[model samples]
Target: MISELIANAVVHGSAGLDEPIFLWFEGSSECLRIEVRDSSAEPPTVRPVEPEDESGRGLWLINELALTWGHGPRDDGPGKRVWVSIAPAHMGLL
Candidate 1:
């Protein structure tokens, strides 16, 4: 899940190869939250997938696996932060 979020940020968020991407993780007994921040203001979106499509399935996977997910303007800069929350039920298997 984290890898997908970071890849999406790198590919869709206009981040340069050397640009910094920040990840923050927070967890409690019942939930875990992951945030990925990159240097683009453009938000991520889910596109309709064709059966033969070989790409563009990252967001779909996140939606299917995450308890909740979203993105917004970065609190620290000009980019955006994409985040996902994993419930306790989902974390146990990890």
Candidate 2:
């Protein structure tokens, strides 16, 4: 999940240049929240998958597995933050 978020930020949020992005994690023993911030304000979408498609499933996977997920404008800057929450059981941390 973390990898998917980061990769999406790199692939979708950046404009082919080496740009900075932000990642955040917050929570306690029961649940964890993850956020990825990038320079693009566009929110991610779960694209329709073709049976033979080899990729484009990142958001779809997040949607299916995350307890909750969403995005909003970044508080500190331009672009946006994509976030997800998962229970400890989901990560085997319980």
Q: Which candidate is the best by TM-score?
A: 1
Relative to the true structure, how large is the alpha-carbon lDDT of every model? 0.90, 0.90
Summarize candidate 1's per-residue lDDT along 42-70 as a digit string, tens digits: 88898999999999999999998899999
* The candidate that achieves the highest lDDT relative to the unseen native structure: 2
- List model 2 lDDT by residue over 1-94, tens digit each: 9999999999998755766888999999788899999989888999988889999999999999998999999999888999999997875666
Worst 10 residues of 2 by lDDT: 13-22
> What lDDT is reached at residue 66 by model 1?
95
Q: Candidate 2, after superposition: displacement of residue 28 in Å?
A: 0.8
Q: Which pairs clash inside model 2? A: none
Runs in model 2 deviating more than 4 A are 90-94
TM-score per candidate, in order? 0.90, 0.90
Model 2 per-residue lDDT at 8: 97
